[model samples]
Target chain A: MAEFDKNMDFPELDAYFSKTSEAADDRMALLELLKRGAVAYRGTEELRKKCLNARELLPKEYRYLEFAGLQKLIEKCKIFDLKNYSRELIKCIIIGVCYYTLFQSIAASAVIFILCLIVMVGGGYMTHRKNAKKLETYYNLAVELRGVFPELELEEDYCSEEKLMSLYDIVQANELTSLESAVVKLKAIG
Target chain B: MGKEIQWLSFKTREQKQADLDEYTRWVFKYGQPQKEKVEQILSRLFPKEAPSMAMMTYLLGRDAYYGRYNTKKSSDRNPIKDMYDVLSKKRYQVPKKDIPLYMALIIADERVSEALDYPPDDVLHVVAARLMEQE
Candidate 1:
């Protein structure tokens, strides 16, 4: 609502909020945090507040967020903000270009195809690198989760989105909690 | 407005204790072999000193979460993320592999680097990822 402050240096929300966003950044960032199982390590105040924000923005899968492929999922969301019907819009553009080029000149069609191929390759390579980084992050997260929950095991298939979601459920279930703050009154009473 | 936030409710003393009472149980009860290995690793890393409370808290927390003694409220928390947040605060390096072990040492032994301050992240991504690979 308030431009979301591009450089808002709130460490409390670093692991919880997204760095950049338009309007949905909060929602997306919360989703990202949930995917990384931030709910596990994140403290009480932050988790509760953020979950409240996410409850409306995200679907029901917040509790079972998986680190795997979430970048792509987020990217898909980002794509939507760029255009109303981005996928359909692109398809229309491609079809229009193809028809024009086919009638204009066969040589032009080949040239356009080559150009499109190069752009596609460049885009693809960028996506690949991005995916690799996200994958490594997922692995690192798996390692951290494994540290606490050995049953997570970090098997070869552990990186799969669905499998990781299951593991995240275990993380949520096995998180370490303290009664220090909440039970202070109770302890004093007893 | 949005749906009311249903963040996890805090556990009472009994509930919290019911969820997590002791750290030793990981070593003695569930993760005996891994505990030994982790202890050996800590000892080897810091021959002069034992791990600090912060480090032990995370290590043991992780073990208990994975082990049988964990509570139902355990699902609401995450020791790894907590530890990483603390460990990553330091302005130094941690290893990519066995980060949990190394962060425990770094947090335990403040002498690891001069730049590091307290309150590292709860989850240790990679030992070196904190310093060398800051995302």
Candidate 2:
């Protein structure tokens, strides 16, 4: 392993260390554990248990590496979940009740309620779709990231977000494409 | 109508050259310590056809120094992708197919610059050696 000039200033590194160490508690312990690298960090039972317990209060995603920039990019990519729509549904109901109570007109109340439902649910769905696309793009970015930094192993498969149809490319290959000629040649050879 | 080509939106030659020059200056100034290590790894790995330090430094620092890795510059493209695009067009003695390896070097170097403070700098050498083993 090569040695870095310890005297150099690195705000990004310091910021990440302080933030993550603060999150996990026991700054020295977390730093020591991180020295083992992200892949090895998961396998260490006692340290991992301690970190995981502490991490639970922060967010579901683990800080896999001390690479602050990459970690921040990963954090920005929100995992799409249908469960997030439940809040929208609850909002719709509240709006419907309010409309009915205020107007005293069932038709107007129903219309307003439906409109609110459509707007809220529709907006949520649009955002979800946009996030899904963003997630796919993020996955592709991750695939490219791992290509260069192979040592950094990710939990998700690189191709997990790729659309099935985009996986293969069709190309021309003379004899391979000419089924009839190939079949005739095959028959003659046989 | 056909979709607008994204490359059309990319910076012109003068802009790119200016960016490259700025990046090169930054690398020379701050990356002096890592230069020997990078050169050492390059010489060891590509003994027969080592790339020039100028090219390596340019590619390594181009995005990281410019803060392109930050989320504020939101775009479909990234540092690795930009490097890949450059490598494809330019003859850097580095094959376009081996982008992953170069990318690893560049990214590891970027991490160091960004101060992945805990693992220490030896990790960079470890990564280079590990990559060498794989090659």
TM-score (C-alpha, index-matched) for candidate 2: 0.26
| lDDT tens readout by residue for model 2, A1-190 | 2222223343534554466445444333433322333333333334333334333333334334333354444444344444667887788778888888988788887888789877987787766565445444444444444443244242322112221011111101121222234334434544
Per residue, candidate 1 scores C-alpha lDDT tens digits across A42-96 of 3333333333344334444432456455555555533423243455446545854
- lDDT of candidate 2 over B1-135, digit per residue (tens): 013365775778898789667755655445554556666655654555546753454444455434444444545334444544444445554564354345445654554432222233444345434434433
In model 1, the runs with Cα more than 4 Å from the true position are: A1-103, A151-190, B1-135
Model 2: per-residue Cα lDDT at residue B100: 39
The ten-residue window of minimal lDDT in model 2 chain A covers A163-172
**Fnat, 2 decimals, each candidate:** 0.00, 0.00
Ten contiguous residues minimizing lDDT sum, candidate 1 chain B: B110-119
Candidate 2 pairs with clashing backbones: A2-B122, A148-B104
What i-RMS does every model get? Answer: 16.6, 12.4
Candidate that scores best on TM-score: 2
